[model samples]
Target: MKLYPIESGNFKLDGGAMFGVVPKTIWNRTNPADANNQIDMAARCLLIEDGKKLILIDTGMGNKQSDKFFGYYAMWGDHSIDKSLAKYGFNRDDITDVFLTHLHFDHVGGAIQWNKDRTGYETAFKNAHFWTNDNHWEWATQPNAREKASFLTENIMPMQESGQLKFIERPQGDFKENSELGFGILFADGHTEKQMLPHLKFMGKTFVYMADLLPTAGHIPLPYVMGYDTRPLLTIDEKAKFLNAAADNNYHLILGHDAHNEIITVQHTEKGVRLKDVLTWSDVLTGY
Candidate 1:
């Protein structure tokens, strides 16, 4: 099995929103905000090449939204989905599965794209089976007031409409048993209902897709939950449990939004599970 870090692009978000009640004095040390008070975030996705399947974890914000809508996020950087795929000698059609962590615009936006002549939407990965949980599919389709803005129909419905949407049934307990898709799934509800973090066992090592549950290394602390989360208190509990498991198992955590740190391992430090060592995906996977 081979894994590639596919960087779609970077965008700016309000630092305060990204780091909940965590004071700017603290988070700013790592993720500094611009004059407009927005911190830079990478729309990093993961690609897995396991035998016949080429699975993509998430698609970064696609270039389909109107300029007015995009102005709010201030998208930046040159890295794009196409460019990233080409770096590995592949393209959109090469993807066999698109495992979405959730339906948030940034996470799934690049799953669909505008058709030629710009009349309607189309699946970005013509051959991929887009995977999302049934509960999340329902929740995103009928979003609550707080999260409605993030669940854009243009970025979602097309996958189902194209007859390529699939879901993993909700797990009965804290963790699902025998739920490995060549990579295991870890469900966390604090960020959003049924956000599936993929735990990949590669080369006898475990690498986890941190997703929004741990957006960056700066979010390693239990209290650094994002304000955008629907359930902040629950997030605290979830983080404590997941981080403990990651440390205990010596898992390599791949951050979803950390622009600098791609992969990191945590240790039982004087200040909780502090980052032990930082490495890139290639460095860890290929022994570079």
Candidate 2:
């Protein structure tokens, strides 16, 4: 199996929201904010090439929203899912499965796009089966007040409407091993209900797609949770358990939102689990 890190684009978000209760004095040292107090974040996606399957994890925010709607996020950069796919000598039609970690706009917006006539939306990946869990599908479709804004209808409903949406049976416990995608599914609730983090076994090693569960290496600290998380206290416990296992097993973390840093391995430190090494995509392909 081959894995490619797809660069979708970058956007700005309030550093305070990204760092949760962690004070600026602390988080700023790691992720400095701009004059407007927003930190840069990448909508990096992952592409998996295995035999007859080409699965994409997350599609980044698409370019369908109005300028006024996008003005709030302060998006920048020329990278996009289409351009990134072309870089690998592929196209949207080449994807067979789209595994969404969650339904947040930044993560799933590109799953659908405006049709040629501009009359309505259509599945962006025409040949793909969109995968999400039953619990998250319900949670996202019937979003609570706090998360409603992030779960836009245009970014979601079209997949189901297009008859391409499929739900993974909610796992009874922590994860389901070697499911359809040939990986373990780690369910995280602190960030959002039943958010699935793929535990992929590739190149004879384990690589966990660290969605919002661990947005960046800077978020390795247990206390550095995101304010956007519906349950911050629960996030602390989740991070502690996941980080410990990640450190013990030496699993490489594939960061989804970190703009500058790519892959990282964590180690148990005196303070807590800390980044052991920052790795590049090439380093992953070449080994160690």
Candidate 3:
């Protein structure tokens, strides 16, 4: 199996919102903010070439939203989903599966795109089976007040409408119990209900997609939770548990929104699981 780091693009978000109650003095050290107090974050996605299946982990925010809507996020950078795929000698049509970590606009926006004539939406990856959980589908489709803005119908409805949407097996227990994914799926509720974090076993190393659960290395500390998370206290508990397990097992965590750090490992320290080592995707995947 081969893995490719597909950078969708970059966008700006309020640093305070991204780091929750964590003081600016702390998070700003790593993710320095602009004059407007917005931090630049990468909408990084992953592509997996496994046998006959070409699976893409999260699609970045597509260029379909109106200028007024996009004015809020301040999208930047030249790395687009198409350019990244072409860099790896592939195209959207080559993707066989689109495994969405969640239905948030930034994560799944690139999953659908405007049609040729711009009449309506269509599946971005025409050949891929867009994967999302049944429960998440319902939650996103009928979103609550706090999350309604993040779950855009334009980005989601088209996948199902195109007949390319499929749900991974979900059982009685936590979603992970029933997740016999090619890699593995770690269900995290602190950020959003049943956000799927893909764990990949590659090159004798475990590479985990640290979705919004751990957006960046700066969030390694238990208390550096995102204000957007519905359950902040629960996030604390979840982070502690996951960080410990990640440290103990020496897993390589791939950050979802980190613009710099790609992969890192944690070690047990006096303060907690502090970052032990940092490496790039090439280093871990191809030993470059």
Candidate 4:
């Protein structure tokens, strides 16, 4: 199996929202804010080449949204899924599965696109089966007030309408040892209901996709939760538990939202589990 980092694009979000109740004076040290108080964020997705099945995890916020809607987000950079795929000698058609971490726009937006006629929406990966758990599908389709804005109908319904949507086997409890997609699944609820975090062993090490549960290395601290989380107290407990296991087992966390910090490992520190090191893709590729 071969894994590649696919950068869909970059955008900015309010640092305060990203870090939650944590004051800017603290988070700003790591994730500095711009004049508008927004910080850089990456729609970085992962591509897995397992035999003939090309699986893509989390499609970034796509380009189909109107300029007025996108104005809220400071979208920047020339990086795109097309160029990123072509970089590895592949294309959208080659993807056989799109494993969504959640249905939020930034994570699942690129899964659907405007059809050629602009009459309606279509699945972005024409040949792929879009994957999500049953619980998450229900939660997203029938969203609550706090999450309604993040779960856009256009970004979601098309996959179901296209008849390409699929679900992973969800087991009772916070973590599932194995998923249909061939990765262990970690379910987090603070950010969104039944949000799945993917973990798979690769390149002689274990890698866990930290999708919002631990968005960035800066969030390694238990208290650095996001304002977007519906239950901040629950997030604190979840982070504490996950970070302990990550430190004990030496799991390498693949960050989903952090634009600059790609991958990381944590160690037991006096304060708590802290970042052991910030690593680049090349560093992980060489297994140093």
Q: In candidate 1, which residue ranges exceed 4 Å CA deviation?
A: 177-180, 286-288
Pick the winner on lDDT between candidates 2 and 3: 2
Task: Summarize candidate 3's per-residue lDDT along 1-288 as a digit string, tens digits.
Answer: 888899998889999999999999999998899999999898999998988888999998989999998899888879998999999999999988999999999999999999999999999988888888888899899999999999999999999999999997764554353233477787878888888888888888888888898998888889999999988998899899889999999998988799888888999999889999889976885665
When summed lDDT is taken over every stretch of 10 residues in candidate 1, the lowest stretch is: 174-183
**Runs with alpha carbons beyond 4 Å of true place in candidate 3:** 175-181, 286-288
Residue pairs with backbone overlap in model 1:
none
Give the poorly placed runs of model 2, Cα more than 4 Å off.
Answer: none
Question: Can you rank all candidates by lDDT, best first?
Answer: 2, 4, 1, 3
Q: Which tens-of-lDDT digit does each residue in 1-288 have in candidate 1?
A: 998999999988999999999999999998898999998899999999988899999999989999998899898889999999999999999999999999999999999999998999999999989999898999999999999999999999999999999888777875663343576788989989889998888778888998899998888889999999999999999998888878899888999799889999898877887788889876885775
Error at 264, model 4, angstroms: 0.7
| lDDT against true structure, model 4 | 0.91
Candidate 2, residue 189: the lDDT equals 96
Clashes of 1: 0
Better of 2 and 4 by lDDT: 2
Candidate 2, clashing residue pairs? none
Q: If ranked by TM-score, best first, what sequence of candidates would result?
A: 2, 4, 1, 3
TM-score of each: 0.97, 0.98, 0.96, 0.98
Error of 2 at 95 (Å): 0.4
Expressed as tens digits, the lDDT of each residue in 123-213 for candidate 4 is 9999999989899999999999999999999999999989999988778888887545777889988889889998888987889888899
Q: How would you encode candidate 2's per-residue C-alpha lDDT over 20-130 as one tens digit per residue?
A: 889999999989999999998999999999889999999999899999988998999899998899989999999999999999999999898999999999999999999
